[model samples]
Structure formats: C-alpha cells, structure tokens
Target: MIKVDPDFITFEGIFAMLLSIKSKTSCGPDNIPNVFLRRYAESLARFLVEIFRSSLSQGIVPKDWLIARVVPVFKKGDNAIVTNYRPISLTVSCCKLMEHIISNYILNFLDERNILSPFQHGFRKGLSTTTQLITSIHSFSAVIDKSGQTDVVFIDFSKAFDRISHSKLIFKLNLLGLPSTIVNWIKSYLHSRVQFVDINGSHSDFLPVNSGVPQGSVLGPLLS
Candidate 1:
C-alpha cells in the first residue's frame, strides 16, 4: 500500500470520502446505492466513525464489509472457458473509503519516518515510469561510453504482491515500531475475506480468500 500520513479521520474527512463516491456506481452485495449514501453523507459519516472506532478497539470487522462481489471478466482466448477470465473483486464503497483514509495515514506516517528510499519510483510522486526509464538509459549510456559493454537483466515482480504472507507483513509492520493498535487494525483488515464469483448473472457460493490483497480496493495497491 502507498502509505500516507493523515491525521485522525474527522467528520469532514468522512464526509469528503462519501462525497467522492460516484453517484452511478453499482452497489456492492449489500445493495447500498451510491446516490443514497451521498444523500445522507453526514449521518452516514457519523455512523461510520462509530463503526470504525469499534472495529479498531475490538479488532473485529463487520462481516458485510469483508464480503466481496467477484466478477470474472474475459481477457482473451476462448470466451466459453473459465480459464480465459480474470476475477475482480468489488468491495463495499464504504469499506473502500475507510481503506483510503487509512492509506493516507499510513503514507503520512511512512513519509515522516523516511521509510521509503528516494530512489524508489513505482507509486511515488514526482517519479513517473518515463522518468525512471530515461534515468536508466542515461546510466547505461554512460557505462557504454566508458567500457563499451553492458549487461542488464530485467525481473518482473507482478506476482510477488499476490504471494505475500500476512504473517510476514505483520512482522514487518512490527519491525517498523508502529503502535500495536495500528498493526492489529491492518491485520484485521486482511483477515476473513470472502468473495463470490458471478458468471452469467449466477453467483457461486462465497469462497474464503486466505491470501493476497483484494485488488481494486484502495488499500490493495498500498498494502502491496
């Protein structure tokens, strides 16, 4: 997750998050429509504040928030085959907003502590993929100028994010000296998730997801 530093979430923050939701977005499994949510943003924010605090102190998340709607989108190959599709999870919009708030806080915390190195490019501000590519080219060009020989190996980390263990993530968080409450909040967020795959308007039974971040959630990329 691209950790961010945000002060404690206030009523204003929650209101803003709720307002940011697009009115036409299809609701999650709970069927709480986005327009309805925005129409009562103030009241919803109040309730959400209570829910979040209760969750943090008790280290328990609402089952509704943990449930996801998984849709198999066809990418290539034969459309008739299940193997040709990729599963995408659509989580509750409210849960996503909460995750986004936490992401901001985590990022701010990391920035204050200088946890990320300056050379890091991916997901960082002021460093685009193009910028990094040009930097690498200049470095390699200089090397060719001096020795006339260059050897470079490019490694892909696409699947690495999906393969992370929760235990290791928790250990790393602990190593960073964050408060236990914050660490537990993260752990709770990562646990007991369930997703139901929808095919041709038919939804399969909810299946437990034991590993990896929930793609498309605000927390997913940052946590990754």
Candidate 2:
C-alpha cells in the first residue's frame, strides 16, 4: 500500500489542471465556458483547491455539479425516429477540473504500484492505436513466416459506455481493491444526476439519470 500525501490538491496542481482545459469547449447548463474558467484560472485555483480537497475528504460531490445537459445527435438512420439519435451529456467544466486532478492521482498511484498491465495499449502514455496496429501486424507476419497460419478475433460492443451496470462497476472497483474513499466518491458522483435533453432548441423536462457516467466527463472513460 502506497502512503500518499493527504494534501495532494495544491494550488499549483489546480492551476496546472485548469491550464489543461481547452478554451473553446462547449459549456454545460451552467453556461460557464472553459474560456471563462481559464480567464480567471489564476484566481480560481486557490478556491478550487479548497473545494476539491473538501470534496475528497467528505466524499460528497456538490449536487449542482452533478447536473448535465444531454444533447441528442442524429445517428445515420431517420432523424424523425428517436432511436436514430444518441444522447451525449455536456457536463460543467469547473466540475471537470476536480475530475481531472482525481483521475491524475488515481492513474499515478496505479502506475507507481504497477497495477496496470504492460500489454494494455489503449488510452495509455507513449502508445497509440497506430502503434498497436503496427506491432500486431509485425507479430502476425513473424508468426506466419515461422509456421503457416495466423488467426485474429475482434469483439466490438455497441454503446458499451451507456450500457454499463452501475452496481457491476462498483463491484469490480471494490474487487480491484480501489480505495474506499474513491469508491464512495464515485458513488456520490454517479447517483442522483439529472439531465435535460435538448431537442430543436427546446428542452425536455429534467429526468433522473440513474445509469452511466456523464458522457464527456474526464472520469467517464475511467469508470466505463
């Protein structure tokens, strides 16, 4: 078990995290753009640091931060059919700053402990899909040259992100021995989120989002 610093969310760390946010990204229902956040990042870092620390300690994420604006985009088939569209959430960027820092801490901790597999290539540092493809191709060629046959299998799931079971995810996280604080915090984050679907500039009534992580959140990929 690694003994990590309790006060990890420093002002400098917050500033660095804020600097990572793209200025032109779409804002959520808060209507507070990343550009607006970055403009005052120097000033907000101190305040955000405290909020992030409090959030971590309490394992209670701000309720307002959990809200999202879900926009449905047309997906190939008929635009008239509701099934032809996919829902994507635009979560608040300020809330995302905390997620970015938390994700960094989790990744660094896992890496330091050698928790991740060396063979894993997706969404990792110094690796890309192209690199994986080239390596795989070379391996296949070498095997073919040595013997005579090679076989490959591909498994693709449609909307795996949207389809994950919350309970199953929590179970897996616990099974993997993630910190209790992080698990509790993730539970708080995943529960009670509300989203309003925007259709033709008109929004549907607010609905409870009981499943899936916020689509565009920094934590989304991690949870999924």
Query: What is each predicted model's overall lDDT from 0 to 1?
Result: 0.77, 0.79
Query: How far in Å is the alpha carbon of 72 misplaced in model 1?
Result: 1.9
Clashing pairs in 2: none
Off by over 4 Å in 2: 1-6
RMSD in Å for model 1: 3.8
lDDT of 2 by residue, 46-70 (tens): 8888888888777788999888888
lDDT (tens digit, per residue) of candidate 1 on 6-101: 236677888888888899876677778899888999999988877766666665667789988887778899999976876677898768877876
Off by over 4 Å in 1: 1-7, 80-84, 125-152
- How does each model score on TM-score? 0.81, 0.89
